[model samples]
Target: MTQHFTAPDRLTAKTGTQWWRDAVIYQVYPRSFADGNGDGMGDLEGVRARLPYLRDLGVDAVWLSPFYASPQADAGYDVADYRAIDPMFGTLHDADALIRDAHELGLRIIVDLVPNHSSDQHEWFKRALAEGPGSPLRARYHFRPGKGESGELPPNDWESIFGGPAWTRTADGQWYLHLFAPEQPDLNWDHPAVADEFRSILRFWLDMGVDGFRIDVAHGLVKAAGLPDIGGHDQLKLLGADVMPFFDQDGVHAIYRSWRTILDEYDGERIAVAEAWTPTVERTANYVRPDELHQAFNFQYLGAPWDAAALREVIDVSLAAMRPVGAPATWVLSNHDVTRHATRFANPSGLGTQLRTPGDRELGLRRARAATLLMLALPGSAYVYQGEELGLPDVTDLPDEVRQDPSFFRAAGQDGFRDGCRVPIPWTVEGSSYGFGSGGSWLPQPESWGKLSVEAQSGDPDSTLELYRRAIAARRAHPGLGAGSDVRWLDAPEGVLAFARDGFVCTVNLTGRLVSLPLPGRALLASGPFTVDGDRFELPGDTTVWWTV
Candidate 1:
């Protein structure tokens, strides 16, 4: 791969008591990030080609979604081989090169590690199937005997998170559990071999110079003592809102404690981040309790509405929970699994029943820009999802025929269906795939996306991409931005959120009408134009401004 930009090794800077506390990490969904080799699918080479871009964007790290060897049953979440890279994404050499390239650009790399389940095509699962019931190989997974007069019924009433029954009967009459798609079998975390195997996998990547890992389904690694029934319908929909027997069980903490030891063993402050969906912020804090993982993604914040009251409540609760555990609160607005915040904010209610509509994009972009500034100004690390910096809205108009998300066909109700946010991002304004690749993209880019391409927004100061670049740069330069742990809630009007951290203050106006708010210091950044009169500034509706006190 041709090198774009290089810098002296800065991995050592990542060391310190809590480097992750206020870090601005960028999430790169590999399949949609960029494509290399004209295959229409993003590869490690594509990521390598874009390292300079991420570096210039001023993010502390790049958290890559899964690109491991898989059946693509769930878009690489189903891992067939933990150590090898899928041919579509490139070889192991490409992965190593990407890691090396990222480090040289002063950017850390965090790859996804899925331990909750493995693709049925995995050698271990294949062996378990060939060996049949009562085989020792089956001990590595959640294999069990069927329950019924003729063993025709499922082992339990537990439903798959993706829909349907969780247990699938093999040709041998035995049943295995899969919380997701049947192709992705849940692993038996109780087994020592499972733990040992994962530890070995962690070491393999760590040895290859990876900075850290984003543990997929981090909370589901350990299920309840017995394979218990959920005993209710739509159990998947209750995830993160209510506790289920299969999720957020106390048993998972033990596994993380052990993994934390392995991470601490490596230099460069190797870390583990949990993609956990707990019932409460306190439960989420359990995953990052100093001895466990280093950070846990705060989905509550991501799900919060644009209303000031809701956003402030979530922020206060999140900070309060993490403070006790001595873990930094992590904030994220969007990811590959959910609706993009730009489109989400456009709807006054936040989540939409239908798809995007007229007047939605304008309102959404305004709120999204305000929300991005608000999230970045908060005291903690923030995650920037790919394409979000370019103000990409969710592709809600995607035809059902081209849908690839497993949840689209399986899960009913309001859960799943993540394909809209996973569309390939536009690079150049004019190309078959908007310069995403030389060939047709896996998912079609919207015709209007040409106006939102990186090339079009690169130099525009008012553009979302430039706003993100400035916000990140300011965060890196300002001592009070990313390193602080708590924000002192400043008294403000009912429809505004005002908080001061260290010597900096941020005020966001969420009200429909304009409001005048006192500024503590010189203006550092503002989401939009504001009127200043004396010590008070007129804050426009859905605007955020940062001031250096």
Candidate 2:
């Protein structure tokens, strides 16, 4: 027989170093977050202007997507120069000012570091292309002779994550590998010069006083030996869930170990968080080993089906995996790449293959609120994607002509178009572009977003924004929330999840019918209001409540 948990008077230990252990970090997609210069794109100045807002929101840090010098091939993920700021975003001085402003507000800044590849227009890639096929410059990238008699075919049969063949032939008649878009070339990390250059890049940013780096494609830096062929199709479909030759290799750990040493040299406990996609939760944890990274995003939790048992299993596995590494499990529900959880959770089918099924938006918003409250109640750090607090739904009906994601254009096998999630956020209900900036937004926002605008919901107690604010405030004040990693499971009926974290008891009802239960203590916060019937309470479906013991 299994033991059930009760409201406890005492709490468990909350141990970890640095602020990231129980911190709440908000992810800002710079191009869509705000437009500071009225240039139709979010820039460093925009981020600087919004520092106070983030501070008021009670976030410990801000993880910015790439704003480095780039051609915007993959929305800044294809870095042309790691040291310089893109003209479209802002000047280098603006970045400095933003960092200073964020730090002053007690909000740490984490920038994206794209280590796996670089823009084709980058100096190194240009030199490799100009120096001809066998030149020493070619050794910095994956350049190889063709396989066919006329050397016409690619050297390997690897598929790009974006879609299509991974190999592209240059004017010099040699094939170069790019795991994503053809305009982005994969770097050869085995070269000593490549490693040294990236180390210097890290130092350059660290010296600039930025708090940390979010390493993109952190697990794909080192490829499998001999560049073996996957020998199968639809490789991109297997990302994050299945093992592939190009990702989650053992050699990637060595590179992270070296980077960890550099982070330790900094004074402000600067950290490195990995956007790694591994086959399993335990495998992803390896990136955050004692001598490696500080944190690894729990993708398993992000992709888990919206079910009680599935979520419980993922939470358990995530916690178990991180226990040995002594690293905090980073929880993320949505990001720039994936569809917003509001729309995703609303769908009857939660799988990636069917992300765009028309579903009940009302039901989705309710479940999203409940899910967010549940995630915030758990131990370790949590990440709130930009606009999630506003309860923005994915813009699934964007015109095909304006869609920008490479995967969307490739028309290959993928979950859905990513542009739906990257629409510029609405700040006000009256202005064009919804006050994202003075100018037009880069991507069109839904006209119906007025009801969800910050201005519209700012004063409403029932708004999703207010709920997030209250939840975050409660997490900070309550000793029970966001403190310990241990969770005491309580016996509950099917379609219900009940757990005790320290002195707090969180109960979530996922079933259709209302369930009556005894109150453990006074209610601190709840996703939805429940009816109280004497000593017992009526918990409505799709609601989560936090009670202090």
Give a tens-digit lDDT track for model 1, residues 325-413: 98889999999888888888888675542344433788789889999999998888899999999999888778889999887788463
lDDT of each: 0.87, 0.86
Query: Model 1 — which ten-residue stretch has the worst lDDT?
Result: 1-10
Pick out the ten consecutive residues of candidate 2 with the lowest summed lDDT: 6-15
Q: By TM-score, how accurate is candidate 1?
A: 0.96
lDDT tens string, model 2, 1-549? Answer: 111122111111111246788889999999999899998988888888888888888888899999999999899999999999999889889988887777666778899999999999999999889888777878888998889888899989888877778899987779999998899999999999899999999988888878789999999988888899876656766777777778998999999999999988876678999999898999999999999999999988998877889889999999999998888887889999888888888887455623665368998899899999999999999999999999998998888888888777664636448888899998899886888899898888888888898888887999999999899999988888885678898988888899997789999998857998887788888888898878889999989999988
Task: Please identify model 2 stretches exceeding 4 Å from their true place.
Answer: 1-17, 413-416
In model 2, which residue pairs have backbone atoms overlapping below 3 Å? none
Question: Candidate 2 at residue 94, lDDT?
Answer: 91
- Local error of candidate 1 at residue 118 (angstroms): 0.4
Which parts of model 1 have CA positions greater than 4 angstroms off?
A: 1-9, 350-359, 411-416
Q: What lDDT score is found at residue 52 in candidate 1? A: 95
Q: Could you tell me the lDDT of residue 203 within candidate 1?
A: 85
